[model samples]
Target: MESKTGTTRRDLLRAAGLGLTFPLLSACGGLAGGGNSSKNQAKSALKIGFVSPRTGAAAGFGEPDAYVLDLAKKSLTSLTVNGTEYAVQILDRDSQSNPQRSAQVANDLINSDQVDLMLTTSTPETVNPVSDACEAAGVPCVSTVVPWEAWYFGRGAKPDQKDAYKFTYHFCFGVDQFHNMYTHEWPQVPTNKKVGVMWPNDSDGNAIRAALGPLLKQSGYTIVDPGAYTDGTNDFSAQIAKFKAEDCQIFNAFPIPPDFATFWRQAAQQGYVPKIAQIAKTGLFPSQVEALGDIGIGIAGGAYWTPTFPYKSSLTGVDSKALGDGYQATGKQWNQQLGPSLALFDVAAAVLKAAGNPKDKLGVANAMKTLSVDTPIGKLEWGKGPNANVVATPILGGQWIKSTDPKYKVDFVLVENSSDPNVPVAAKLQEYKP
Candidate 1:
């Protein structure tokens, strides 16, 4: 893995195209064990571990994680809780999106690197072992992309099975959110009621299917024949033909961004536009929007946060604008999908602030359980039900309306807001027409 030296505060602002005059670099004295420091003060050099695949197939996801972590570290120093000062040090680990490598890297972070906390993107194949390592070490892990069920139910073993790993927490809404959007929301479209699903035959796809398959039948929806496909089989023409044969009305896709784009182009070329299509994840990133061009229009999808939604102005006395602005200044776009990286930072910040000291993992864990920090996405509360880490955050359903601006190719129409946990799944279904 390639590593770079840490940047100074000034360098970060310059990279973000912002002007900075604050003497933040010199303000480190308080954090560096200077005057009036207590003898038992927590170690000043606070280190947080960041593990992501910065070099493999998921580099698109991993690179942004690293960039966003750097951005958050730079800005979070200005944050304080009850007059306590803290500094963030990031240790980068390249998991390369492999399970064994992810486990090894996670073990290193917990055992040798002495990371106060761990931040990671969860893949079903990779996250389980890493979660086990963290659980064993008593480390608090805040995963940006791990699905809610992985943290809630524990993936490898049955929900009732013993020896289940339970140290990690999911910071983002996972397949359950997707299932809610599809089973509950997509049915609302009166014209295009039929559902067609095309997913990769991998662990990620299986997890999604496991959650949605049973629900689809229970919801009285038609499951088109020849549903799922394995990875590396580029041609989706056969599957498109099946959808055409089934007269599928609403096309639902869960493939990765590149495969999703290819499937979309193939479907378009085959004259198979299913009144409207609802896609998840990869389809919502800015890169997908730019790559697919006009072919990407009219597609509806769910997202955690968007620049479009309104959030609380005050978040427990923290400036929400500063957080949002810091994120926007980084120049990363999420198609319509809100990057979970920012949410992960908020989770970390919440734990850090509540703990008052950076070195306490148990304190961080307890703080996370009760955290209700407001973010640009809205007010977030960790689910206090059976599941601990899964929070009831807002998921927005947006349309890819034709762009009015020549420079920008597409814009979003906020069709409906699915923020409320009490909002009936049936009602969300009724409102979310593709």
Candidate 2:
């Protein structure tokens, strides 16, 4: 590691960061480091294991990964710890958006590759299993994108569990963020306050349904929940018919990319379009909107990252605009995953340096338990978050619309930011006309 650069390229000599992997070592490796043995491992190149969904349904979140990894490769070529410099290698893997694969890759990184630290992200499917693998293996891990509640409780961790998941920490929005962003963003359009929610049977769906549904009800809106549907179900006729029959004027959902697309297209075909189709988990990217052709124009969703955010990546010292511009240079529209995905390594680099020795797993985990690094998304600190092992990052409300800009076919305009007013609003809300 070099003080000037701070990190180096992690190789695939074995396998992945997510457009979300947000690093590794094993049981007999850095976990019990000290004296000459510790020094020996510290002198070796620091290996980081990154996991994400690059080839599956959640691929939208992985779109900016290559660009982010490229920047990390250039900026992370060297790392400095306790005045000692060591080479860095980042090994990234693809979850295929499957939780089982996520666990397998994480185990491979920890037990096989002997990664020093671990970072994974995107959704619970990718984040939870990878985090769980690290937790069981005693490897320090960090992640983002999924709601904090989903990552925490969904992992069978209780609020009073006392020091739950010491090896794994998380940073992302929670139910309260949805209560704020949705309550503030939805009222922009005149409605009867009737919301149709389609929560799935997965981790994200279960968490949202348990917390967010009640909040919307307390806010004086009538929630019509169609119960939990299994993921990858191509038919949503029953759910659509219920919404249409109830005359629900607003809609909400937390589903994977393909599931949402299938349900949404089915809803439209069945004549069940809502005025404010506030969505989560999906519809946060430009290509997602482009997939629906014109139907995606006014559909609303939450943004975990965007170019308008007035922040910068700590590793490359590139702000939101610079990051966005760099991706646009690649001829791809900017994505919300760009900031957080890159931020994962930003925190990883900081954690490695703060660990005093890159090879010490306990030191790395302890550092992750407290280290707060300024990232492209915002300030991500562990203890400062909602729980000891969680950082409640900001989530803003936005909508997809036609883009006059030559580079993009559709533009994601920020319409509400009450969750974090520091994030400036770009445009007013537009009602989705069926």
Query: Each model's TM-score, in the order given?
Result: 0.74, 0.90
lDDT digits (tens) for residues 1-434 of candidate 2: 32223332353222134431122232223234434565676567888999999988999889989999999989998887777778899999999999999999999999999898888989999999999999999999988889989899999988677468878988889999889999899889899999998899988899988888888899999999888999989999999999999999999989888988898888888888799988888898888889988788899989888888898988889999999989999988888899999999999999988888778888888888779898999888777777788888889999888999976789988999987788889988888974
- How many pairs of residues in model 2 come into backbone collision? 29
lDDT of 1 by residue, 1-434 (tens): 21143446567567446543233322333234442354334455566777776655454566456446665666665446566555667787888767788889999988888888887764554555666678788998777564555544545556554323345666556665666656545645664456778866775666667777667767777766475687556799998898898888877766656578778888888988776688765655555666787777677776665554455323222243444454556664333223455566666777777877657788776666767766555566765533565564556566666567565566655555554443222122222222
Error of 1 at 319 (Å): 6.7
| Candidate 1 backbone overlaps, count | 4
lDDT of 2 at 232: 88
Which window of ten consecutive residues has the lowest lDDT sum in model 1? 425-434
TM-score quality measure for candidate 1: 0.74
What are the Cα lDDT values of the candidates? 0.62, 0.86
